[model samples]
Target: MEVVAVGGCWCDFVSISPKLPKKGQTILGSKFLTQHGGKAANVAVTVSHLKGKSAIIGRVGNDFWGENRIKSLNELGVNTNCLQKTSGHHTGIAMVNLSEAGENQIVGIPGANYQVSAQDIDKYKSIIEKAEVVVVTLEIPVPSAIRSLELSQRISILNAAPAPENCDPALFTLPTVFVVNETEASIFTGLPVVSFEDCKKAVKCFLEKGCKSVIITMGEKGAVFGSDATSDPIHVKCPQVACIDSTAAGDAFVGVLAYLMTYRKDIEMEQMVEAACYCASYSVTIQGSQASLPTLTTLQQYFLEKF
Candidate 1:
C-alpha cells in the first residue's frame, strides 16, 4: 500500500526579529526573510522532504503570498491540487520574534486560513479517503478540521497547536494520534506539564477522552508518548544541538513522526520518537520554516555521523 499523507492548515508569510520588543518599546531586528510557514504547510513540506507522498488541503489568498506559497510547495514536491486560493482574503501572516537564545514569540493573523470550510473538505473527500494519514492543525477553522477527521479512514493525526479557548471537546475524540506540546497539553488537561508525572497525567487524560495515542513534546527535554495499546509512558530524549531558530522544530517533529508511522509501521514507538527528535534537533540548527527541513539523505547522513 502506498503511504500518502495530507495536511490541512494555514500558510503564512513569516518575519523574524532578533529579539522581542517589550511593551511600548521597539528593538532593531537582525534578520528579515519571507518563508512558507503555517503549521500544516510546514508539515507537508517536511513530509515531502522525508520522501513521502504528501498533499495539502487548505485555503490561501489569491494574492502574491498565496501564489508564492503554492509555488514553493510545488517546488518542494508536495501536491497542491487541493489547496485553494480565495479572492476576498489575503494569505495569513505571522510576525515572529526570535530571542538570542533561539526562543520565539509569534502572532498570527488568519486571513485566508479562516476560509477553509467543511465544504472544502467535502470537495477533497477522495484525497482524504485515500491518504494513509491526514494531518490537521488548529490554524484553520475548527469545522474544517472536524470535517477532515470525519472523512479520514485509517489514521488522523491532530497537531493541536495555538491552543484555542473553548475548543469543542468532541474534536478530541476523533484523532488516532494526538500531538501537542507542553502548553497545549496543559490547556487540554487543565494540568501544568512541568514534570514527567504531569505529562503522564495529561497523556492518560487524552486516552480517557478516546484518543488512541498521545505525544507531548517538551522542548530540549524530549517528548513523551502514551497509547491505549501500551501500559506505560514512553520517553525519548532529544539529541543536544545548538539552537538557531526554533520556528519549525515542532513542525519537523510532527511531520517526521507522521511519515514514520505511515511508511514504517513496523517500527517501534521508541524509534519513531527518536527519528522525530533527530529531525527536530536538526531543524533548529538552521533558519527559516520550510527551508529548515532536512531531506531524507540529510537525515541519513546525520544519523550515520552523529549517532
Candidate 2:
C-alpha cells in the first residue's frame, strides 16, 4: 500500500467558548461536540482523502467509543484489517476546551492507547513492512512506537508531540523523518525557537540525534524544513485564513506530506511541501480536528487555485 499510519485512537469531547476557566472556576461553553480523533486515525483519514491506500494498526476498547472509531476509520476508507479490539479497558478519551481566539487546552485520559504494547506492534509487522511510508505519533507507548519504527521497512515519519522529556536512545538510530512543532523543538533542543535561526539550530540538533530530515511547524508563522538545503531553511508561509479550531492542523500537514511523497510521483519536493502547507492552512479555517482536514477536491478548488 502507499502509506500506513499506526498509533492510538481517542474519542474527543470538546467545548468551545470565549475562553478557558481559571483554577476552581467553571465557565459556560457556547458549543459542545464529541468526535472520533486520534493522531494516527486522523492521519489515516487525511491520507485516504488524499487518495492513498492508508491502513491503521492499533487497539481500541470494546466500548462505544471503540466501536465508533472503527466505523469512522472504515467510513473514511482506511483499511482496518489490523485494528484490534481489546477485551478490557476503555478507548482513549480527550477533554478539550477552545477559546474564541482559536486557542485550545486539552486533557487526555489515554486509556486503551496506553495499553498498546510491544506485542501488539509485533502482530502488525507484515503490514508495516509493506508500505511505502509509515507515519507514527506519540499517542501510544514508546515501546510500541519503537517496535513500529524497528519493523517499518519504508520511510518512518514520527511526530513526537506531547513531547516526552526523554525517550529510548534507540529511537535516535532509526531512519526517521522528524516532525515537531515549535514548542516540541524547544523541548528537544533546550533553546527557545523565537526565530528561523533558532529553528535551524533545533533542526540540526534533531538531525544529529539521528533524524534524516526535520520539519518544524510554527503555527500561523508557517514552517521551516531542513535537510539538503544548506543555504536557507525551506520556509513556507501559512495561508491567510480566518482562525478556527487548530487542534489537528499539524496532523493534517504531516498526513498530506506523507501521502504526497508516496503517491504523487510527478510532483517535486517543493510542490509537495507547498501542498502540505496549504493543507495545514485549510485545516485552521474549520472547527474540530479530523473534521477540519481538507479533501483533495476542496484543496484543488479553494486552496490550490492560485498555484
Candidate 3:
C-alpha cells in the first residue's frame, strides 16, 4: 500500500524580515518569493523526496495558478489523478511573511478549496483503502477533510497546522495521529505552553479527548510524542542551526514522519521524532515550503556534516 495525501492547495506569496511589525508599525522585508504551498501538497512533495509513492487528492481553480500548481505537483512525482479543477473561483492563495527570527504570519484565502465534496472522497475510496498511511490537512473545508478522514482505516496522520476549531469532534475519535504545533496544541487542549512538563500535560489532554497519539511540536525546543497508549514521553531534540525562514518546518516534519512509518512499522517513537526534527531543521536553512524540503540523500549528508 502506498501513501495517499488528501487536502487543499495554495500558491503562497512570501516576504521575510528581521522582526514582524506590531500594530501600527510597518516593516520592510529582506527578501520575498512566491511559491506553491498547501499543507497536503507540501507533504506529498516531501513524501516523494523520500522515494515514496504519493498521490494528491483535492481541488484547484481552473485558472493559471491552479493549472500551474497541478503541473508543479506532477513535476514533483506526485500522482495528481484526484486533483479537481473548477471554474469561476480562483485558486487558493496565501500571503506568508517570515521574520528573521524564524517567525511567520500568514493570511490564506480558501478559494476552490471550499468546493471539495464528499463525492470526491468516494471517487478515491479505493486509493484510500489501499494506502499504508492516509494524510490529510485542515486547509480544505472541514467537511471535506472530515469526509476524507472517514474514508481511510489505515494509519491516518492529520497535520492540523494553523489549527481549526470546527473540525468534527469525531476526528478525535479516529485511530489517527494528531500532529500540532505548541500554539495549536494549546488551542486544542486549552493550555499554555510554558514548560517541558506543561507540554506533556497538553498532549495528555488530547489523548484524554480520544486521539490515538499526539505530537506537540515546540519549534527549536524539540517535539513531544506519545499518549496514554504509550509508556513514556518520547522527547526528541532538534538540531541547533542558524535560522532562516521557518515557513514549512511543520509540513516537512509531517511528511517525513509519514514516509518513515511506511518502512519502519515498529520504529521507535524517538527515531521518528528525531528524523522529523532533522527534516524541519533542513527546511529553515532554505526558503519556500515544498521548495526547501531536502531529498533523502541531501538529508543524510546534512546529518553527517552536522553531527
Candidate 4:
C-alpha cells in the first residue's frame, strides 16, 4: 500500500443549519445528510480518490452504520481488509453542525471505534511495516495508536485532532511529522498561538519534544511547516473561497500530504504542504466529508482557472 491509515471509521450525522444554536436553544437546519467520515476513513478515501493505493485499519460496529461504512470504503476503492466489526457496540457517531459561513462544531460518540485494540494493530503489523506513509489519529484507542506508531517503519504521521485530554508524551517523539491546528498547538505548548510568531514557537516546542517535522494548520490563514532540516519555519498562505461546510478540511490536508509523499517522491516537503493547503482549501467549498475532498482532476482544473 502507498498509504495506510489506522484510526476510526464512522458514519457522520450532519446538519447544515443557518446558524449554530446557543445553549438551551433550538434552530431549524437548512439541510441534513449522513456520509462516511472519521479521520482515518476520510484520509483513506481521499488517497484512493487521488489514485493512490490506500488501506484502512480500523473498527466499526456490527450494525447498519458499520455495514454502510464498509460498503462506502469498498465502493470508493479503499482496501478494507483490516476493517473489523465488533459484535456488541454501536459504530461511532458524530453530530456535526455547520453554519452558513462554513464553520463547524462537532461532537463524537466513539462506540466501536474505541474498541480498536493493540492486538488489532499487531495483526496488521505487516501493512504498517510495508507502507510508504503510515497515518494515525486520536479517534481510536490510545493503545492502538501507540502500537501503530511503534510499528511504522517508513514515514509516520500523527494527526492529533479532537485534541487529547492528556496526551501521551511519547507521541511527540515517535512520529516523523506531527500535525495540529492552531488551537491545539496552544493547548499542547501552553502558549497562545494568536499570531504567526506564536505558531513558530509551537513548532519549536514539538521539535524539542523530538518530532522530526511539525505543521501547525492556522485554518483560513494556511499552515506553517518546520523540521530538523532547517532553523526557519515556512508558512504557506492559502486562497480564501466561499465555503458551505468544512467538516473534513483537516483530514483532507493529511490525506493529500500522504498521497504526494507516497506517489511523488521527488516533491519537497514545502511543496507537499502547499499542495495539501490548496486541496484542503478547496474541500471547504463543497459539502460532506469524503464527498468534499477534491480529486486530482478537480485540483488541476481549479488552479488552471485561478492562475
Candidate 5:
C-alpha cells in the first residue's frame, strides 16, 4: 500500500437548510441526501481518486450501511480488506446540516468507529508497515491512533481534528507532519487563528511541542507550513473560487498530501503543500463529500482551464 488511512467510516445523512437551526428553533430543509463520509474514509477515497494505492483500517457495523461503505471504497479503488465489521454495533453515522454558504454543522454518532482498538492495530500491523505514509484522524479513539503511531515505520500524518480536550503532548511530535485546520489549531493551542500573524504564532506554539513539521489549513486564505529545522514558514494562497460545500476541503488537502508523500517522495514539501491547497480549493467548487474530489485526469483538465 502506498498509503493506509486509519480512523472512522460513516454514512452521512445530509440536508440543506436556509440556515443552521438555533436553540429552540424548528426549520424546513430544501434538500436531503445520503452520502459516504468519515474523516479517514474520506482521506482514503481522495488518495484513490488521485490514483494512489490506498487502504483503510477501521470498523463499521455488520449492517447494510457497512456493506455499502466497503463496496463504495472498493469501487473508488481503495483497498478495503483491512476494514472490519463489528457484530453488535451499528455503522457510524453523521447527521450533516449544510447552509447555503456551504458551511456545515455535523453531529456524529460513533458506533463501530469507537470500536477500533489497539488490538485491531496489532492485527493490521503488516498492512500498516507497508506504507510510505499512514494518514490518521481523531474520529476514532486516541489510544488506537497512538498504537498506529508506535507501529508506523516511515511517515505518519496525525490530522488532529475534532480537537481533543486533553491531548497527549507526544502526539504532536510523533508524525512526519501534524496537520490541523484553523478551528482545530485554535482548540489545541488556545490561540485565535483569524490572521496570518496568528497562524505564525500558532505554528511557533506547535513546533515548540517538538514536531518536525506542522501545516495549518486556513480555508479560503490558503495554508501555512513550517518546520523546526527552518525558521521561515511558507504560506501558500489558494486561488479564488465560487464556493459550494466546504465540508471536505480538509480531507482533500490531507488526501493530496498523503498521495504526494507516497508517490512524489523527492518533491520538496512546499510544492506538495501547494498542490494540496489547489486540490482542496477545487473541492469547494462542487458539493458532497468524496463525490466532490477530483481525479488525476479531472484535476489536470481543471489546471489547464483555470491556470
Candidate 6:
C-alpha cells in the first residue's frame, strides 16, 4: 500500500550569500543558485524521495519560477495536481544569506503564498481526507492552514516555523505532532528556550495549550520530544557532520518525521527520531534548499556508515 502525504505552503526562489550584510554595508557573495523551496514543497519532495506518494497544495504565480517549480516537483515524483498558479500574483521568494559557520538569515516575500485561502483547502478536502498524514506550515495564510488541519482524517503534523507574532491558541491543538525550533518554541511559550529544562518547560506549555505531542528541535544539541502519552521526554542526539548550508535542515527533519508517521507507524519513537535526526544532519552537509535533502538510498548509506 502506498502511503499518501499532502502539504500546504509556499514555493520559494532563494538566493544565497556568504555572509549577511551589516546596516547599510555591502559585501560580496560566494554563490548564487535557484531551487524549488517553500516548507510545503520541500516536505512533499522529501516524502516522494523517501518512496512515499506525495502531493503539494499551494499557489504560485504563472511565471517562469512557478512553471519551473511545478515541473521540478513532477520530476521528483511529487503529484502537482493541487499546485495552482495565479495569473496576477508572483511566486513566493526568499533571500537567504549564509555565514561560513552555516548560520542563515532569510527575508521572504509572501506573494502568492499569502493568496492561499480557505476556499483552496475546501477544493482539496478529498485529498486531505485520503492522505495518511497532512503537513501544514505557517508560511501560508493561517486560515488555509487551519482549514487543512481541520480536514485531516488521520495524522496531522504541524511544523510551526517563523512562528507568527499573534498565533491563535486553538491552532496549536489541531496537530497530532507539533514541531518547532528553539526560536519558535520561545515565541510560542514566551520563555527562553536555552536549556533542556527550558525545552521541557516549553513542551509543557504547549501541551497545556492543547498540543498532543511537542517536539523542540535544539539544532546541534539534538531534539526533545514530549507527549501526553508519556511522562518523560525523549532526547535524540543529532549526528555530527560538517555544516555547509543549514537552509533546509528543519524542513528535512519535518519531512522525514511526517514520512515515518505515514508509512512506518509501527516503528518505535526513538527509531523515528533517529531517522529524522540523520536526515537533518545529512541535509546540512550540502548546500541549497531542496538540493540538500537526502534520498532513501543516500539516507540508508549514511546509516550503514554511521551505525
Which residue pairs clash within candidate 5? none
Candidate 2, residues 58-86, lDDT tens digits: the string is: 88898988988998899989998888888
> What tens-digit string does per-residue lDDT give for candidate 1 at 133-154?
8888888888888888888888
Residue 211 local lDDT, model 1: 83
| lDDT tens per residue, model 6, 137-200 | 8888788888988998888888887699899875788888899999999998899998898999
Candidates' RMSD to native: 2.1, 1.8, 2.0, 1.5, 1.5, 2.0
Q: For model 2, which pairs clash?
A: none
Give the range of the ten consecutive residues with the poorest summed lDDT in model 2: 298-307
Displacement of residue 235 (Cα, Å) in model 3 is 1.6
Alpha carbon lDDT at 264, candidate 2: 76
Residue 35 of model 6, lDDT score? 64
lDDT of 3 at 256: 87
Using all chains and alpha carbons, the TM-scores for the candidates as numbered come to 0.93, 0.94, 0.94, 0.96, 0.96, 0.94
| Better candidate by TM-score, 1 or 2 | 2
For candidate 3, report its TM-score.
Answer: 0.94
State the TM-score for model 5. Answer: 0.96
Cα displacement (angstroms), candidate 1, residue 193, comes to 1.3
lDDT of 3 by residue, 1-307 (tens): 3788888789999888888878889888788888999888888999999898998888999999999999999999999989999898989999887887778898999899878887888888888988999998888777777777788877888887667765568667664788998888887777997577888888888888888898888888889998766976677888887777688888889888888888667766667778888878878888678888767976576447656
